[model samples]
Target: MVSKVTTVAFQGIEAVPVDVQVHVGPGMVAFNVVGLPDKAVGESRERVRAALSASGLALPAKRVTVNLAPADLPKEGSHYDLPIALGVMAAIGAIPAEFLHGYAVLGELGLDGTLAPVAGVLPAAMGASALGKGLICPAASGSEAAWADRDMDILAPRSLIQLANHFKGTQVLSRPVAKLHGNAGPLPDLAEVKGQETARRALEIAAAGGHNLLMTGPPGSGKSMLASRLPSILPPLTPRELLEVSMIASLAGELAEGKLTDRRPFRAPHHSASMAALVGGGLKARPGEVSLA
Candidate 1:
């Protein structure tokens, strides 16, 4: 019999579904992982083995074959550690296979059986919520997943033993609360400037109209001061805009403590940045500075 666990892969900010299949059956005493996994994923076997051992579970002397489905898609990251471990557990009857049917799991596992936080938990939670499934992630990332949906079912466990205990009804895990950042502390006051009346007026106009501003002047012209104070007069981001900005920041793994903020993002790319850097399309096709700004 095969035990399957659902997880996700990332392409840019999008989360793509991945199936981790584990089978333990009569044959030579061997363990193998298949599918087009990258280096990080290929090495999960050792981590999973050590983690399970730490959790007091031992692999049976049977052929253990794990396959990541959709064989062509490149699987990556140590986040697969949790789901893969869970799949193995389910296959060995250490945990009930039916218990995991409703959830998608992602987390990195420490050799001591602890769950380590990983990037992209927010996006993975969002994907699971969209699919009408619960999410299981590291405890440190619970607050991040909580932002996806207040009603979504989430289980954030600190370790493999803790999660197993929860499933066995020996312990219970609490849902995490979504965290929000307080108001961006005090924007620079526009009144501090003593001169540059023209620049000040232009700044005012741009703030009022939500228009972009480019200040061109020689050194010591108060350009930097004027730009810094612009936020004082600019309106705070609307709720929808705040979420949009937060999503991009989350995808970039920049959201601290999983706290959402109302402050508008301000990005300053280096002058040497190429057009591709500004407009996107590097080897990984990451979001561009222009888009982020």
Candidate 2:
């Protein structure tokens, strides 16, 4: 029997759906994963094997084939581990196949059956919500996923055994609450600057009118200091802007403790930063500093 689970592949900040199809059937005893998986995804077989063994379940002594569909999309990241493992579990009847029907799953699996947090959970949660499905992510990332929508169903488990128990009705997994990073005191205020009245006026105008301000001055003339204080003078992000900023930060793995914050981002790239570092273009096309800004 073939059992399927839903997950996502990220393109920039967008989460594209991918189906994990696992088939455990009669054949030579071998495990194979296919469908354009990158190195991290290709290695999920060993991780899944060891995790299941640690959880006291072993792979069936038959041929096992895991296919990530659509055949043309290149899958990346360790986030596929949980979905693939769950697909195999359903295939072997370890968990009821129908139990996974309405959720999207993503997380990395440890050799000892623990679940590790993976990046892009927020975007994946948003994508799952768009599909009218719930989200199953690692416990560490549950707070981040909870920001997708209040009414969306979310199941966050710390390990394979914990999730299995939840599915088997031995334990119940509660939805995680969305978290905000506590304010680390107040931001550096423009009032702290002793001089540079002209520069301060420019900063105020830029903050009030939302216009760009370019600062140029000799070293120790407060150019960098004034720039650092700009966020303090600026208004807090609107709800939509907060989500947009947090999503970019989430995809970049910069959201500390899976918590969001209302403060505007402040990025100061070094003079030696490369084009790709500033603009974001690599083999994976990850979000760059500008996107986080």
Candidate 3:
């Protein structure tokens, strides 16, 4: 027979739906990931096996194939890591099918079977919310998932041991709260730059109205250093900005500890970035600096 669960394959900021289908049948010892997985997804077989073994479960000496659909759409990201692992968990009867039925899950697994954070929890939460499903994420990503829903059913399990326990009625998993405070500190008043007084006045005008400024000069003119201090004067990301940044991090699969980055983005792209890299149009259209920033 077969078992199925849902996760996502991200193309830029857009998340394409994917179904993780697991089939367990008697045969030789072979594990395959199908439907156009990239190098990362192909490598998940070893990680999945090692993770389960650490959790004290072994794959039966049977042929197992994981089909990520739709086959025409290429699958990407380590965010598929946990859902693939749990799909096998369900197929092998290690966890109740019902427990997984309502959630769309994703996370990378450690060889020792701990759950490591994966990117894209924010966008995944958005997709899950749209579908009215909850999400299961790595414990480190719990706080990042606070944007899903106030009563968001996002469960952040610190480890497989806890996950298994939660599934078997031996433990409970709590919801993660979204709380990040802002701070204001005294600044070196614009009156401080003695060498470039004209430039300092321009800086004040730019800072006062939240207007963008252009600084054209030769090397060693302090252009770079002046740009670096912009954050010292700007505001923090709003909850919505945090969600967008978190989603970019999620799609890139880089959300850490679910703590939204407090700084607004300021980017200077390299002239060498390829069209695909610049436009989020790789074979999978990964997030370009425009999307990430």
- TM-score against native, each model: 0.89, 0.98, 0.85
Residues 1-293, candidate 3: write the lDDT tens digits.
57788888776666666899999898888999999999889999999999999989999889998999999987776777788888898898898877887888888888898888877777778888888889888888888777768887888998887888998989999888874533346443433445776776677678779787999999789776676666566777787877777777667655555666666766667768877667675555567777776
Give the count of colliding residue pairs in each prediction: 0, 0, 4
lDDT of 3: 0.79
The lDDT values for all models are 0.86, 0.93, 0.79
Ranking by TM-score: 2, 1, 3
Badly placed stretches (over 4 Å) of model 1 are: 182-184, 272-288
Residue-by-residue lDDT tens digits, candidate 1, 1-293? 79999999888778898999999999999878898888888889899999999999999999989999878888877899999999999999999999999999999999999998887888888899899999999998788889888899999999999999999999999998987777656877999888788888999899889898887988777877788788778777896786667666666667777777777666667779999978876644557887676
lDDT score, residue 220, model 2? 79
Give the alpha carbon lDDT tens digit for every residue of 1-293 in model 2. Answer: 99999999998788899999999999999999999999999999999999999999999899999999997999999999999999999999999999999999999999999999988999999999999999999999999999999999999999999999999999999999999899899999899998788888889999999998888878878888889999998888898898899889888888887889999999989879999999998987778878878
Which stretch of 10 consecutive residues in model 2 shows the poorest summed lDDT?
A: 284-293
Which stretches of model 2 miss by more than 4 angstroms?
Answer: none
Q: Candidate 2: what lDDT?
A: 0.93
lDDT of 3 at 64: 91
